[model samples]
Target: MPYLMRAEPYDASIGAVRPLFFSDLGFTSEPADSPSNTYFVRRIETPLAVRRSLFSGSAIGGYSETSFGSATLANDDGKLDWLSDLDWDGRLVEILYSPQERPALADFTVLFSGAAEQLVPGDEIEIQLRDLLVLLDVPASRGQFGGTGGVDGTAELRGRDKPWLIGRRRQIEPVLINAANNVYMVDPAGFSSLLAARDMGVTYPAAVGDFASYTALVAASLTGTNVATSKTAGLIRLGQKPNGRFTIDAEGVKVSGAWVYRFADLVRHVVTSMTTVTGASLLDVSFAAFNGLQPAVLGYWCDGSSVPKVRDVIDQLADSVGAYWGFGEDRLLSLGRYDGPAATADFEFTERTIIDLTPRPVDRRMKALKLGYRPFGVIFTADELDRVNVSAADLEAFQNEYRWTAVATNAAAAGASLLATEEEGKTLFDTEVAATAERDRRLSLFSAKRKAFDVVVPLTPGLTVGHTVKLTDSRFGLSGGWRGLVLEIERDANDETLKMTVQG
Candidate 1:
């Protein structure tokens, strides 16, 4: 049978297939280290909290009352309740500090009735009731003030717009004309005696108690304890009053209070929660697309030595396309192992010709293995052989010069016509022979012949099928082709063999 010499590198005398190299294939060189493989960016975390407070009173009071009834001893108008018609409604105020000294400070005290009285020179009685009241009011006033600017509440009072109050009392009173007054008699010395006369008890406003509870409620509303409490405490101390209802302002304008849940905690919870949920070591929140389907398998018809670890080769292939995916290394080995033997044998036998010839003198009766080498001969179909476009004269010229064989139309047929034979047969044979010889001569003159034909026979890695692929090599003349998917990949550890089922 006539054989066709597949293109090879040394066949410069005849046309051969050339393989493409990396550079010639139009592939740009990738940096040894790619940013996609190394760079990792993380998101920033936010902060959050809750707060509470009590006694949100103002710096000014507008009401007071006085009464007098019993008087005893050598006392004058001793037992008395000196009262002023002043407003006591609490006003939200931001505290302010003053370095300047002014007489207005002294005059301001008159509004609160800052006065002192003494009954006797030796036996002293201090009528410093106004001073004591002022002293008690200072702490409450300080607490109401808020912010660095110390502006008393906002100019626009809270509760006025919403018609609702936050603390217990939320009403504005009218100014009274007549000064209501009262006088109570208690011998300066007997005042203490009266206190001793009956068991004394102090009463606190119910609203004050409620304010304490509300402060805590506000604090708890903040998510992160430390952050929440700190901010809430600041708002209360600063006594910031928003331009709305007292309750609304208190609830709304609080530090970081506008947040749903502490943003800081939310971030932490999301990252931590998702990590546990996914059961993945590396979890990332990104806008990149994720594939729901498993990766497809690709098969290559390569020599056993040329095929590396399947996983590595596949990964390299995937990397060329900037894809992020993973597969077990064993799977690649299995595919390579399974296809290795068949591919190796086919490549060796089809691409190379082995001649086993024995050279010996007619001496001892013995047999030995001797090796000889020759170029791969060309094979052509009978139809191609018949269509030789050459002249009879040319055929005689070439056949007389070189010992060339005329391929038979049918091997079973005998006595085919040859040169120096019958008219019709001679004519056909001469023409075909000349054409074939000339074709071979032209092939011999061609210089850039292929040394090897890197046939890429795509097979599936597993059960997957019909995968498209592009193979590029500057030194090789191959381009795009389709690769088959993988059906199964199995590895034999004991025998060190990898087997694979690839789509044909």
Candidate 2:
């Protein structure tokens, strides 16, 4: 197998990105051209190698540890001296492999592709690459406001027309009314008291994109009264009326406007709007897989104090609905529901291919995990019946109200505990029925055991994380095949070994 490497560096002289190709086929000899499938690349003798680490965790809310590793190239002939004049940051670098024995193959398998972060020139050139997901790290505001010219979320949108919040969304109380602009500068922190009052039964004030009127003075005065038992029920009812300038909806309130986005649409907005380090725009993000999952209505409030990152919005949306997300080999964002394994195995690793395999069972057990949304201060505990369990000492919190079910269900699926974790401080679910449905979903996926493994095998070309692998190991058991979801993959040019973490 011969490896082909391609690097695209921005050439200031040409005022455009220039692509350079290198190969490991010719050493200590003159450069020669060799065909790799349909494309012919230059083969040079100098040392060239790459190490890549990729993670596409199969579980919703699962964390991925990403490192694209480094690529070292030979520069002994000074033929690569021109690289010093080019910008390395955000340039494209890719590795492709083709087996000579498999000449029938028409294309080289793209082993890795990412943005080159740095270049250290010497006899050997070392280029550091970073995952493309880093593109979404930009601040999540539609536009900046107050201090300087900011993003205007209402500006004509590109791609899909789904409206998204310019900043954070909260259960706001109008502290100041800009009667001149018909805008309400809200006190986002004021609603906690009303939500914490169990008797208030705080209703979603109005339809989305509509403003509800209220007064800060009236809300503050009613805070101390017991709306459930006080004979002054009439006075307590005054707090829920709309006499303020705040825009209100079932999701929350925004200062100047409302953006009630569907779960999938919000995810797409953050993804498509981001610009990658390579100056590549992700305007073509694929959402066909995303729209197939369970849909929910989600929104947020944006203020000077609370600007979100694009990655954060995607994660929050995915985690809220038991979905997983990652960039695919196509370099586009992909999302899927974490309900179960893929319907069919992508490939099989049996005795013929597997070198070694070992089971790694999680031992940590939990008695209870408590979580709460910050806004409503409603707390719920998910308890697991086990022989040994730990207490809910670490309290988890979320920004949105309706994420308890997703969190709990995903926790249970991850083998953290047989029961889903609970939130205690904030209530994301507004109705008992909704809360119960979330709890039931968590219960259905609960399990006392989690199956995971570390597998060692020869280089598996075209293998990507999140793909299913059917394993058959006669050494451990019968010849029956077992399906497992690929979570993480590690491989280097120094060896043919591919290390993977597989969960079933």
Candidate 3:
């Protein structure tokens, strides 16, 4: 299967020119939005060796493990050496292909897209490409520490030096003020002392044991930094305006109250907040796709002290609600659920269409799936008392494997029906209801005998991860009506083979 591949440079431009003598005639500059203001694309076409792999999670609690592929260009003529120019550093490169059998250049299709990594010129110009997900991998710092004697106040006591008199204190200023909910987001910045656990204010230390006086000191430290909203179920209520003396103690405020948001809104908030803070071009958010997601709520704490990777945060949030994150073929990051695929399969592959097929091993010997979770509205930690474990077992089997997540309260309900033996753990989720639901959902998925297949078919365009498709194999008893989720795709333009890793 012969094909032609080309790489188009991003942000390439040439200076616009006009006859110098025409200056007397006077000409207006092209508006920024004008079509005439477009940049020139000097297409780079050369002998190339490339391999591309794309992936997405097949179920809840899974994530893409794709390392955006690589390409090598033959620079025998030195014609392509210009790619070493500093101007091309970190540029977006669009890879395109045209079937040798096709006659028209217009028929060319976008095979892959990515940001080019550093380029080192040599006999062969090698280029590394990274997918859009790379943007989400940036480390996000939520709060800045002022150290011992800076903006955060000193570590010493104001007057005397007794244990109760001298303790660390913090005054949290608003990081983000959401007028829609009257919520002021503040990065706790590792300040562990606060009192209110829920909307109804509860006094500190009294609820957290004998540190009442110390809790008072911590509460007093955070006098003005509080959730300004009226008391509501599951929402944080800090000191109300005029009566600004510290009200909540550290232990309670640590898990105090999370600002509840619709799953979609929460995702947007997190992504936008990170992008705005870090200045990373995270592409665009699929608002409509997220809004169409199943009904769920996310409780997010503003404790940015851990400095987690954005990808982990988003993945855990989705997993908590039986959802998964996927970057579509178009490179748009979207969310989908293991249980809630499209009502109908988008594509179907039959014996006639499948060139090669190998079924993945099925794990039926597993006896039970014990999923661990914590009650809602609590900070994630290794505390055993703060966690709950629920199991889904097949009495006939003896094996047991445990998966833990900090973000799921209803693990029992949101788990997928088909599960694999190995799964990574995450800590995120605010309520037991969500955790239990997730546990049940995973138990159902893990207890069943799930099957996956490595399939190679003729170049199939428009195939993407997370989309459900039907498969039929008379020998395997698949009637074509059964749908499987696409977990990974490897496209080899050289051989015209489109390989897929699918699970059902």
Candidate 4:
């Protein structure tokens, strides 16, 4: 299908923005869009995120300042100036492109992040539209006409995305939660309270859509009590949120709520929640079940002092199930797990439908495993008065399997040490068992490789990232049904086909 595209520069400080130009030359590469990886730019002292490319093919037009081909901003392009306001680092150069060809801009659907710093000169002023935004325009370099005196080029225009209300974020001072901090039930309400505590407003439906009223939610480490109660606790950071969702103006914290069921739950919630989180609007809040789907009833709580950022909460939630999230379809957020339905081989692809394919070598660093155990089974027990007290140890023989084992250890890994976190289960044996199970799970998928291919297939319902696809060829050792998680899918406007990246 032919798609209509628009690229506009919007400023959150201003009301609305109009597209200065639209290009068929755009090639957007979104490696991942979940909160953990949806971060767009890396500033001067910051590290780079991913390898980005330019918007090749055609030139953009319409602005009077530099007629689609001007190198310098001789005339004031207010939006460009606004982005420059962020110094060298910037997100104001956002483009809202939609399939909808409408008169009013409010109806636009998908968001397009504008460009990175322009290295080469030309009319090639870049704008990024990515999981956040994507762009890096460079000229043919030489053979161009000069103004008059000497050879001149557009100064390397560097800027990041102007702050948008949706993904705007701020980081709280770090809080260590080792049984020494404030505590509360980090529920939708408790989470909202953290936002309120930060002077940010918290919004959610009175009744949780797909969530339950389960008693004894997860214990916390932020306050007083030790058990799963509101009295006292603390929290720890399971994962980190990217830099995008930090800033908010006087509006404080604007949150919309939604509920999704398990079986199809955490992955969908993390992906759609971050990407499609339209300002104050969240997923449908109707009291709908997963359509009679008897999936696991889910709700999460944590000490805000530890799991502070919104993305961190989502990341930690999904991490509990051995899953991590990133963007896939057109920078749409995605959450993928190491375990899914096994497809032994059938979904094969041949040279007829596959133009070319590239398989990435497994990065052991990305999937390192270090199982841990309590040297001596011990833990903190709560007293009758709700105070935390480190109880005694049981030195019983043959009580458990192996007392301790470092099954998946890599001694070369930056000076390895202990791999386990302190267990807080009711029984010391139960805690040790839980720790061992997690260790084995991580060992199974230690060698993971994400592959990308240029295919003639369209990215239909079954062909998106996170779906299973099979490959059969003597080259890729495809005798078995090697399943790979689709990491990215991009439509080639020129080829009129789709390209998919998958990780197995």
Best by TM-score: 2
Runs of candidate 2 with Cα error greater than 4 angstroms are 26-67, 101-105, 146-170, 173-182, 185-247, 250-260, 274-286, 363-439, 446-448
Q: After superposition, how far is residue 175 of candidate 4 from its true place, in Å?
A: 10
The runs of at least 3 residues in candidate 3 whose Cα sits more than 4 Å from the true structure, single-residue gaps closed, are 1-60, 87-90, 100-106, 143-185, 188-202, 205-260, 276-294, 300-305, 340-343, 364-370, 375-427, 479-482
How high is each candidate's TM-score?
0.13, 0.66, 0.62, 0.40
Candidate 3 per-residue lDDT, tens place, 1-504, comes to: 223333344433443211110111122223542223333233222312333333243333445454465555566778767666444434555555555453233454666655556566776666676656666776544334343432232343122111110011122122222222222223332223333422212222222222222223233322333332212111222433422222222221122244324455555555555653221332244455655544443444433334566676666666566656644446565665666335689888888998988888644423344444432222222321112221223111112122344332224333443332434343344344555565657655655556778888877667766667788877566864567777667776556677877777
Query: Which has the better lDDT: candidate 3, or candidate 4?
Result: 3
lDDT, candidate 2, 272-357, per-residue tens: 44443231333233354455444334444443345567777666555444555665556655655544357689988888889889
Candidate 1 global TM-score: 0.13
User: Candidate 2 overall Cα lDDT vs. reference?
Assistant: 0.48
Candidate 4 structure quality by residue, lDDT tens digits, 34-82: 2122222211111112222111111111000100110122123333344
How much lDDT does each candidate structure score? 0.18, 0.48, 0.45, 0.30
Root-mean-square deviation of every model? 50.1, 11.0, 11.9, 18.9
Q: How accurate is candidate 4 locally (lDDT)?
A: 0.30
lDDT of each residue in 237-284, candidate 1, tens digit only: 112211221110111111123221121222122222222212132222
Query: Against the true structure, candidate 3 has what lDDT?
Result: 0.45
What TM-score does candidate 4 get on C-alpha atoms? 0.40
TM-score of 3: 0.62
